[model samples]
Target chain A: MKQDGLTIPGLLVASLVGLILVAALLDGRGAHATPGEERLFLPDAKYLKPMLIGFHGVAADLLWIRTVQYVGTHVETDRKFPQLAKALNLATSLDPHFLEPYRFGGLYLLYLARQPQAAVSLLEKGAAANPGRWELPHDLGRYYYLEAHDYARSREWWERAATLPGRPDYLPRFVARLYAETDHRETALELWSEIYRTAQNDSVRSLALQEIERLKAGSSEGPLGL
Target chain B: MTVAAIALNTFREAVRDRILYAILIFALVMLAGSTILVTISVGGEVKIIKDLGLACISIFGTLIAIFLGIGLVSKEIERRTLYTIITKPIHRYQFILGKYLGLVLTLLVNVAVMALGLLGLAYLWEGVSSVRLFLAVLFIFLELMLVTALALLFSAFSSPTLSAIFTLSLFVAGHLSGDLRLFAARFGGAVTKLSAETLYFLLPNLSRLNFKDQAVHGFGVDGGSMGLSFLYAIFHIAALVLAAMAIFERRDFK
Candidate 1:
């Protein structure tokens, strides 16, 4: 009746119950994951945007990291990301000027996830917000060329990028190829030839040569497989 | 001369606070922890590091200012030294000003330490330490000065707990004033809109002092904006400090 501590038996029982509860929670979480649970139920950026007291850049960076992890998680298990666009949208809305999410995240949607329209929209959003920067525009041009195969739109984006400061020197060549009304096969060959010319490593140079030789042989396929 | 003496003494006392060291250690750890977080990110490693680092400095520096600043007056009163000090040759306004200055000095040293840590991390990650980051820190310092003044104003007449609540609330409100104005203008009714607009203009508008985005991206911050932020902070701090002095002037210390 006095102030004696809990006996070893009591602690052991408590620990057993605690471990079982944790296991139950884990099991429930895994079993009950619907589309709603895919993104961990984080609210839209509009609701959470004002609460941070103007730490939008930091918020955007953290959200972008989460987006990458979300993509990675889907890549491993089901390869079905129902909330990929939502995740990307949340990060971009928090910081419209953040280009990495727009750039690499767009590539993920296009090449990896095969969601072409989402990729184009995201890249266009980035380009619209950051017209002064060429990365988004350049990536847009590449996406249109590789996946969409819309030469006119691709050339327009490439020209915009080429005019912007800090664009890669090869961007003008891409624009030129588009302007000459060359077909996708010839343009693809020229692109690889340029890569072969400027290859810094033996492996990259070899890859470029293979791509170029494949194109030159008039294979019906395109470069940079989707 | 007397204010300077009080300010130096206050600075010495504030430096010994254990809470300051705790906050400083947490900030340094976060700055270093960002490196670990960057390993998984596919791009913007340098930008992520810089953004997190600057956010750490701003958030922690404001905590330091508010936490230390709130106690500047109450601690002396609690220690029963206020009576002894006020009876001396210094006026109450000078006392308030000196206390504010001392905390500002403390924030300067703390912010500079955190700034150097952030710049060092950014350099290690990116191979180039941008001097423009300091421009962000400069604006953060101005924000801290305004927060300190708010804390001092509340501490002049209220308990430390209430003072912290008031100061922190105003700090958040100041940052959100712009958004509040937008929401009010777009959605609110006639009277509600008018009141929100008035409060928005009357508040400190701390978001104006935010330059972290400019630092992370580029030097989009021009000279005109910096000058405007500085002038805004000066006016707000002056008004808050004067209010604190008036409250202290009429404070009836039993």
Candidate 2:
């Protein structure tokens, strides 16, 4: 420790001292300048790159975990997540493998954030990366089926998702039900009721409940005097 | 003959080591404690349980491998037991291979216990069982075998402290190797790039063994990829154990 030309600790300390001296010099130089009122959050891109990568991954993971939790809380309270859409997007953007960000995150964005376009874009990206994954397609189908009420489009998405690897055997049944929703609203209601009961996350359950109520209300209105 | 006998003897010796009990108890406790941990997670408590359970298994499994592995050969030599064993009827490779297999067997039993704890926690939290969770843990257990083999190789030639440190560094680097190469490509200098590239190929590339993420989301893990990874880890372990045997065979007890 005493005789080495530059031990690892000494080298690290010397570098720290040099950095402090330079920072002090920069501060001294900036002292003469007038303080400007105008300011934008334009951080130094060079330094920010590493920082962004570090924070983005951490934030993305944090947000994903929180979003999953929020899904449950939202369902229990029957609340819309109009604010969580961007956070969810930010998470998925940072970590594309985060499949839930596309499925349930899109759900929040569509129903809660009231951003169907963003939801569509999120699902599309998820579907592309995870083509063999069923969750994204199922959620995409949900967006069209319940939120958009475009049965034809919903059926298309569901059918495609149901064909993916590892999809539940019940997926085709759900697809068939989607097509029959117009004639059999009650069946849809019952299915959604089952989904709501079995739902792991609260937000999804709340969404299912909303759909059930809508279906019940619609059925009672007696099928638009066809 | 002496090498095989020593390795089997060491295996029997290590099974009686108290450190194994201490580590296994801690691991099982943590796995059991995951039930409480799950409640703190936001809404996806099952996901939380799985995450914590898998993490506990990996961490404790690595600890057992490292702690026991580092001493497997070094302790025998330190106690002057290797001199007796080495001058007798066994081959050096048999000793190394036997010791490795024995430690691996210990790891299997320990992992099974921890996995049972995980499965129990999952059952309690979600009221459902995941065969996939067990399969994921199985892969992780296999990965730890590679770590144990590497640790033993280092122990054969180095002091226990150095072996432990080297093995731990390898563990961290192995897990982060993919990310390291990506970072190097993006921003590293010439020397950093060369070293990163060299280490990429030289190391075991344990990230391939990671299916925890897939398990967490209930995503479909590629069976082909998993099979390839298992083979890679096995081959790597065999090569390390053989190298350790080569080193042990040449070293003079005097």
Candidate 3:
């Protein structure tokens, strides 16, 4: 009840009033438009590693979460990334054994950032560091098969990945179809059908069915019967 | 006989302190909470859980070591009980060592409890016993022991507040000593480089004891390094405890 500046309740009310006044003033001036994807100023991990006091794993995790958010922001905004590759490199360097940065970060680079070589390089680094992991090599195989269109490289990566435990059964099927089909359209159809057969959920199955139908349509002289 | 008696006494006193239980409970809670944090991670569930658990154990262990350790001597003096203890026929070095051992015993129990919790959680997460996590926890326990000795040495000669500050400063410096050497070599002249190297050699190179990255990453931590780290910790802790004993022996309880 007493209006003393040093008292707890007095200070609370004063702070609340001060905050409201600031907000009212800012509101009168109008809210500023959200800036374009802000700059990502990432220090080199070599220098940053020492400062983290051996907690670089969590630091890398937090940076990865931020990097994911960064990709999302760019995806929804200008669709241009000036710093994603650097962010991935730094995050991976901060904790080389963190597989997500290598696996999903590589995916983001390949598809979202549209830096195919950078994506390949990130996955290569991951595969080299984590030789036992299948995902990196598997993705590299997928990239070679789908994007690079290099059947030989895809088969090579897929072969190595298939040997590692936990690799999906789809790998050898991919390799078999790679060798069996001379026609690109037929290869695409078979790949989609395998994906449909092994699809984990309805959405994936639907996507695969669409791809199968589209490939069928592309190669078909008539729609009802080939 | 004297050291064991005093050590057991000191351990009993430390075990009774509320702060020890508080820190222990908080650490367990943090370990459990790591599961929730990992839900947002697209992958690395086991990793996030392991890393956070290890970090929680290391940090809370350090807090207990510092908070409880700085009071190991000064609190006795403050309560006017030091005069009674020193008046006994026991050598002051034995008392100091007893206190150090007691705190270390406390730390060992705390670290062990936390380590088991982490291993069980990790097992449930991945269904395999992570011996590597235990290795990391062992090194962390060694690090905490060294820190407790540092706190004892500081508390022997300084107030608890100053002891806490000095011990914490040394902990940070120890962790950064390797980086200091690197930075000095990269950016400094001959004198600076020499000074940095000397300090690096002088300070406890805690990174030498670090196998967390290796363990969590599935990197092979050789028995040689583990043995070396064990010896390194013993040497640092012995030196700190001896120095604290010497200082404590010279101090006038009156």
What order do you get sorting by lDDT, best first? 1, 3, 2
What is the TM-score of each predicted model, taking all chains together? 0.88, 0.65, 0.83
In model 1, the runs with Cα more than 4 Å from the true position are A1-37, A186-219, A222-226, B187-194
DockQ of each model vs. true complex: 0.46, 0.08, 0.41
List clash counts for every candidate, in order: 0, 10, 0
Alpha carbon lDDT of residue B159, candidate 3? 97
lDDT tens readout by residue for model 2, B1-254: 54455556666777798988999899878767756654533345566567767877888889999999998889888899878877776677777888888888788888998888888878876787887787789889988999999899999999999999999888877766777789889999999999989988888787788777677667777889988988888888888888898998888778
Task: Give me the TM-scores for chain A across all models, comma-separated.
Answer: 0.72, 0.59, 0.76
Instruction: Tell me what fraction of the real C-alpha contacts between chains A and B each candidate also makes.
Output: 0.66, 0.06, 0.57
lDDT of 2 by residue, A121-219 (tens): 988888887777887887777666655667788889889988888876766887777666644565456557766876656656876787778677774
lDDT per residue for candidate 1 within B1-254, as digits (tens), equals 88898899989999999999999999999999999998877778888999999999989998999899999999999999999998898899899989999999999999999999998888887788786788889989999999999999999988999999999999999988999899998999999999998998788999899888888987566889889888998999999999999999999997
Q: Lowest summed-lDDT stretch of 10 residues in model 3 chain B?
A: B37-46
**Which CAPRI level is candidate 2?**
incorrect
Which TM-score value belongs to model 1? Answer: 0.88
Candidate 1 collision pairs: none
